[model samples]
Target: MKNARPLPSYLVQRYHGWKATTHAENKAWYRRLAEEGQRPRAMIISCCDSRIHVTSIFGADEGEFFIHRNIAGLVPPYAPDGDHHGTSAALEYAVTVLKVANLLVVGHSNCGGIRGCHDMCAGLAPQLEEKTSFIGRWMDLLRPSYERQAGIADETERLRAMEKEAVLVSIENLMTFPFVQAAVESESLTLHGLWNDIGEGVVECYDPDSARFLPV
Candidate 1:
């Protein structure tokens, strides 16, 4: 706490601008949200990449979504091992307490986490393979995905596939939670996978029918 400093000058200026315009305009809505508490309709798990903005992409308003962002937007399989589990805890709260109707995992193109996992699996990134690296351990969840796409001869296509595969892998891992599986089976909750191309402004949803990601 001692190391913390005041807000940057630009951020302070921007905050004042937002407070004068956006916040002022939506004062009643903000007040109502504060009073009512959140009852989000969906939980979106997305990459930590600053470029991927779930609300902006979905044209959503505040309180409409419960979002969790992490590297590669990965979700680990359910493990109640007493240690800290941020993503899993979020998922549990979303499904059980919040009772969200939908759970979505959004992956994106040029994901540094995915690329690192790919390279690490291929013996190309020794730093990521280090035992002390938290990212390396987190990315180990995607090793199976990397193995599946490692044989692709084209690098571009392979990375793209890995990005989408990350979404699918997360979705698969989500099912490993008993509560999630029960909710899904009882029609109380639904799971979705999506991939976005950052530069192209294109979004795609996984089509389980064809096992492909088609434009959304």
Candidate 2:
């Protein structure tokens, strides 16, 4: 592309460092993964937050999880409307092709996308309310979540709840896929919702029994 540029110096150095050490150490395992293809046990849909390291958090290997990152980790409802659906495409491939046994929608603390949705819904962000804003349109998926948490009076509490609600919304939307429903009904696939408190270094899992997020 015309605007394309070489990798930054620090990134390049890091890549070389990783290639010489970690990649070298895991050469055989990497080779095996390449030859056999990936058979990930789970598919994780998470936010594009730099701090929330999914693999590091779980101590997962490269081939163990199929991860898709997007703003606020939001998942839209099953819409086969022929528009460009990156998240849905990834989900379909994970469920139908990879046959991942578990699908996790992970949300995290102080999510900018979630905050934007909160502000936009409250009529505080005019830019996000604009028709041409991609983030705005994408975050519309979480509008229901904002509305659901309107009863909360405190700003911090309401935003925190909205963050968790994003995970719920994604999980609920994931089930809308026909293949996902089939796999789940047959007990082949299980769904999970998770909220990670980045600063606190705590991960909470959604407990269906109590309908609450309990620490993992």
Candidate 3:
């Protein structure tokens, strides 16, 4: 990060203002969180996109929700054999140690990762077709979704469907963890899925029984 530029002055000034106002007002709450440690009620795995604001959407407070973000908010199928698994590690800690009651996978429309997967698989992104491309390798996680949506005729609908598919796939992948499965069986934990329409500023929650997303 040595080459990283300094943060803009405006952002720093805003932070100072928040410190004097928001932080000052909630000093005791912050202290309590630091002292007693966080016991979040849910773990939200979401996209790394700037448009997807997890805490803002849910109106979550500090230490209220354990959040992990990745490209397209994907959860790769349970592979305990991998050498480096950042998302899996975070999930393990959240489920087993944190004992969060709810695990949520939130995906959004217009995801670059999902689009990249569509392009790379369709031979649109020649650069991403390279085996060594990290983004390409990461985007492979969503390939199953692409295959599933192969019947969709409209390009826009396909993209939207893929976005939702990412959420559904993540929900399935969460079960691949032994602890997660055990928790779900014991009724100690529940899984939820959400898809966001960034332009519309609308969110839809996935209903397992209905197999559809209802407005939230």
Off by over 4 Å in 3: 1-6
Window of ten residues with lowest summed lDDT in model 3: 74-83
Displacement of the residue 74 alpha carbon in candidate 2, Å = 0.9
- Per-candidate TM equals 0.98, 0.98, 0.95
lDDT of 1 by residue, 127-213 (tens): 988899999999999898888997999988998999998899899899999999999999999999999999999999999999999
Model 2 per-residue lDDT at 102: 95
Which candidate comes out best when scored by lDDT? 2
> Candidate 1 vs candidate 3: which has greater TM-score?
1
Cα lDDT for residue 201, candidate 2? 93
What lDDT does each candidate get? 0.94, 0.95, 0.92
Model 2, span 1-216: residue lDDT tens: 979998899999999999999999999999999999999999999999999899999999989999999999988999989899999999999999999999999999999999999999999999999999999999999898899999999999999999998898888888899999999999999999999999999999999899999999
Error of 1 at 163 (Å): 0.8
The digit string of per-residue lDDT tens for model 3 on 5-100 reads 998999999999999999999999999999999999999999999989989998999998999999988888889785899999999999999999
Candidate 1 lDDT for residue 140: 98
Off by over 4 Å in 2: none
Q: Find the 10 residues in a row with the least total lDDT in model 1.
A: 142-151
